[model samples]
Structures are given as C-alpha cells and as structure tokens.
Target: MGWAEKRTGIAFAIALFAALAAPDAYAANGAYAVDAADISEVGSCKVESWMSVATNTDFSAVANPSCVVNPFTPIELSLNTNRARSDGEWSTTLSPKAKTNFVPTGIGRWGFSAYAGGSFDAATGENLSAFAVIPATYRLSETMRINLNGGWLWDRTVDRHYLTYGIGFDWKFTDTLQWTIEAFGQAGASDTPSVVQPRFQTGVRYRPNEIFSVDVIYGRNITGENANWITLGTTIRFPVEGAQPEHRRTGHL
Candidate 1:
C-alpha cells in the first residue's frame, strides 16, 4: 500500500481498538481532540472561534475561517489567527491549513481524511511549527461516533519531532445538543518518550439550528503547561447554495 493508505489502515485500526480498549479524540472540524473525517460541503464557508480562560489571568483565543471552492470541491482551505496572553505578555500567530477527506463518514461506514498545516509568526513571518494528521472515523449510529488520529508534529521552537495520537467521542443527546470528549498526546521521536503529559477536554455543544453552534468545555493541560482552562466557543456556517448537506449535519464543524 501507499503511504497514505498505510496510515489510513493504521488509523482505522486504532479507531476500532480505541472503541474497544479505551475511549476516544478534534479541534479541526466538528469538535476538539481529533478532526472529523469529512470536510465542509462544496461551495460553503465557516468560521470557528473560541476563548480560553486559564488561571492567573492568562487567556487565549482563536478564530478560524475556512471554505471549500468549487474546483477544489472536497478540500478545505483555511487561514486563521491565534492570540494569547500570559504573564502580562501577548502574542499572535497565523496558521494556514488544508484538509480533504478520502472517504465520507456515515452511519455504519468507515471514513478517513488528511490534514496538514503550519503556524507562523504573524509579525515576523518566521516559521514556528508544522504538522500532518490522519483522522479516521466510525459512526455507530446517527447519534454517536468514534474518532482516532495519528500524525507527526515538528515543534520548530523546540527543534524536536513527535508522534501524535488522539481519540475522541461525539454523541448527540438531542436534536440540538451534543457531548464530546477526547484525550490526545505525543511521544518523542527518539527512543525516550516525551516528558509531557497528555491533554484532555470535554464539553457540551448547543445547536439551535444548522447555521450555528456553541460550546462550553473544560480542559486539563490544554497547552502542555499543566494548566486548567474553561473554553467558550462557537461555529458559524454558510452554504453558498443555502442548504446543508446530510454529512455536514451529522458531523461537527
């Protein structure tokens, strides 16, 4: 098999294994921990924003806006901004990413997708970090799904490479409310594993309709800094054709 196929196989295996052996992992599409194995519908655009509050008056916020062009069809292109404040200092970074799904997610079906992105200094334009992730998903039913992720991260600031892994679960409690949880971590590239601990998050999402959704999440070690945080987030979608796709309706933004 090819490289992507191999990773695809491994990711799917991990997803199934996680369902039986463990639990679940997105920040990419629908929820946070692992990304969704689907992209926005063609001719559609979306914006996701979240504010995180940590102890000691530290704060972080992100605004991600993305769209799928007609010719690119299934691929999503996004350019986003991340701003943070810690210890009386503030910093901003810009991230650009591209994502596409090889298989569509559905009830009783397997799905997979690839995401690649990098972050750069908004002021100096210096490269900071880059990553590539493969996300695999299984929808046991319309209301529940399992997601798994495997990838590589280049932490340029630290001059290190790490293998990344994540697992997460998404479940709909009602037509307009859902719950999600995930655990994700990384291991060092060398023989010794990473000294950092895993990060975790769980939250409820409220969607009054197809066009909008909001989230309230609690996170532990969210940035590998051993800090606890509360996040308030929102997602807004607008389809050019003015109709939502079935797949988009089933998955998170």
Candidate 2:
C-alpha cells in the first residue's frame, strides 16, 4: 500500500485504542461494583469444644466437644461425654460412638444422623449400657428448623433395649440467640413399660467473627423427674472458610 494509506490505517488503529481505553470526564464511577473482599469465599471447616453444667444430674459439669468436621458433609466421630460428680458414687460413663448425617433429597435440604455408643458403668469398671439415635431435621426457614429424633437404650443389667422417639425445634431469635424444645422417651415397645420425658432448651450464641463462636445453653427436663442444666462453651475454627450452597445471579458490564 502507499505510505499515505498505511499512515491513515495506523492512525485509525491508534485512535480506536485510545477511545476504548479513555473514560468520559463527565461520567460518574460505577454505582454498583462488587469489591474483591466482598466476593471472596466466606466460612471454613471448624472444630469446637463445649462445657456443660447441671444442677440435678449426678455430674454437675462436663467438658466435651467433637473433632474438626464440616456440618454439610456427613460427620463421624464421638461428640460428648457423661461424668459422675464423685468417684465412688454412681458411675462415670466412658461412652464413645461414631455418627453420620445424610443430606435430605426432596424436602428443602433435610438430613438424618445416626449415632452408636457403648456405656461403661464405672461402679464395676465394666461397660453396662448401649445407646443409639437416628435424628432427622428439616429447615423450615433460614432462621428456624425442626428435628425428629429416635433413640434406643440398652442396659446390660436389664438386658433389654429401651426405644425412644422425640421432636426438637430450633428458633434463631437473632444472630446471637436461639431457643429449642424437645421430648423423648421409650414408645412402650420395650420389654418393660415405657415413660416419656420432655425437655426444653434455650441458648445464646455469640459469633464475634466468621472463625469464632460461643454459646450458652440452659436446659430443663420438664416432664417425669424434673432437672435443670446450664452449659457455657466457645469454639474456634482454623483458617476460616465457608461457601453458600445456593445458586446465585451475577451481572457483568
């Protein structure tokens, strides 16, 4: 091509590049822009520990918590413990068990968890009781959930399994407070006559940040023989991380 045509082509290319790179002086900045910090991943795999105290139980207090695991995935590990107030009195339970929770398929993310544990009656330094529970939950909303739990207890001294089933409701009153109620007992199918026990629990959870949380729970065995319990606990998660399971929409310019 001729020098005049070549120069014209080069000038046009340079003009196009400059027009695209330059911004209008009179135009304002984007009104809705997502910052990298806001779009970054939130939440993490965390391990938590707890301490509970009771006024009516043989053991006045206990410290127990589970190992590190994600709540969305199935959890398999021992969760807590039961202790005796004094050594020579009743028995210190050294019960350990495995547990797993399965996600619900059809009903807005329902889940079921199963636990199996053996009890040791410290009086004789021998295992005396076996226990298991299958608990299911349905999320009623972002702030509320209902759980149905069935449990079985077998005492070595009696050689019979006690079956129990109950329901629990959790209400998140705020970002830092929650309330719960539950009722459980043998359903009269066991060899011996069954009795029902209803319980109520209330708690406040303090989450100062994404990686740390603490909760205080107060409970009462409402029916049958009445008893009260209080629990104070804190949990810390390492290298905090979390992600929302729900789908989202995005707009791009």
Candidate 3:
C-alpha cells in the first residue's frame, strides 16, 4: 500500500487497540456546526457521515469514524476521509484528529477541550495541512447552551496560516430534537482583521435513540465566493457491553 494508506491503517489500528483496552465505556452524540466540548466515553466507538451541496454546484462528502478510551477521562481519536467534486474534477483528503476534554463539565458551569489534527490530500499523496483548536461550551439553562471555537490552521498548499472562529447557540426543544444557529468566520494570513469572511448556519438535530441521531443544516456565506449550501448527516454510536447508558444533555454526539 501507499504511504498515506499505510498511515491511515496504522492510525486506525492504534485507535482500535485503545478502545478495546479500555473498560466501562459508552458513546455520545455530536453537533453539526459547532463542536461540543465533550469527548466520547471510554471503550466506545462512533461513526459520522455527511454530504453537502452548494449553490455553485460543487458537491462534497465526508466520513469520520472515531473511537474513545479513558486513560484518565475520555479521550477520542478519529479518522476522516473527504471527497469533493468541483468543475468536473474530484479530489479526496484524509485527516486524523484527537480531542480531549481538558476541563470537565460543572467547573464554572463550563466545559473545555483541545483538538489537533492534520489533513492529507490524495492528489498530492502527502501531508496537506494541520490545525489546533480550543472548543468551549457553557450551559445557559437546562435546555440551552453556548459554544465557542477558536483555532489556527496552516494551509500547506499556500504556505500560509489562517485564523478560525465560531459561535453557536444551541437549544434543546425536547428530549429528541434540538436546534442550533451559529456564526463563523475565517481570516487569511494576508487579510486584514476586518476583511475576514463570515458565514451563518442553522440546523436541527434529531436523536431517535441512545445510539443514533441525524442532522439537517442550511447555511449561507456572507463573504467571498458567496454561496448557499445544505447538508445532511447521521451518527451512530457503538457502546461497550455493560457500559452505562448515556443520554444527550449537551446536544453532542
């Protein structure tokens, strides 16, 4: 196999080994626009897949399968593969990410996590970029929460770096349904702080059971290359035997 493929395989093997070695773990769901500050439960696994279509006729899809283990608390490791078709050409990319909740919930009524990862483009058959982000969430009420994310990304293709930020408001309407709205933006390396590109998105999530959920989202770019888009996604969790049942309290998967 190629080097990239081998790397992917090795990553998966390590994540699986960690998951299998852990004890007493469960699974959790995630959000669509903003990331949650929670990690998957120890010894559990989850898979998420989504497809997005834009007004410019570009289509893209991604699959992310992740596993969790607790050396202390819960830590997650995931692999992502993305495919896109634009202007009659297709390209694929792979990314492996690790996330952990550094500050547990109920501390100052807030939760915090750190995420880091790198992406590899199949067209180049090599590393493309890397990123690190801090995701934070605050509980507003029993049914409402707020999410914030900030990060820096190194764009290998351009040999430049960019800043990313997002804010999300999430409301749980019922036990099985929730709604979210978010505003996000990006600033390029050479762009002025005031010249950043911004986007707005709104989505709904439906959790039919403890182990499965789906989301639908609509968004529009208000800056550069403006386009409207829609996406649909689903997530499935595999809980380890004898693990305690966990419910969605923060709208995270």
Query: Per-residue error at 149 for model 3, in Å?
Result: 0.5
Clashes of each: 11, 5, 5
TM per candidate comes to 0.83, 0.59, 0.80
Tell me model 2's lDDT, rounded to 2 decimals. Answer: 0.38
Model 2 stretches with alpha carbons more than 4 Å out:
1-58, 68-75, 86-90, 105-109, 122-125, 187-196, 222-225, 236-253
* Model 3 Cα lDDT, one tens digit per residue, 1-253: 2322222222112222111011000011232545656444466787878787879776767777888755554557877776876556687877777776665443238777766777787678777777777767787766777777777767676677777677778787888898988876566754433325676778899988778889888867522236777878888879666654554323332
Collision count of model 1: 11
Give every collision pair in model 3. 28-253, 29-252, 29-253, 30-252, 30-253
RMSD (Cα, Å) for all candidates, in order, is: 7.0, 21.7, 9.4
Backbone clash total, candidate 3: 5
Report lDDT per candidate. 0.64, 0.38, 0.59
Summarize candidate 1's per-residue lDDT along 99-194 as a digit string, tens digits.
666776767888887767777878899887777877888898878898888888777776787788888888988878989898887766543232
Q: Rank order by TM-score, top first?
A: 1, 3, 2
Better of 1 and 3 by lDDT: 1
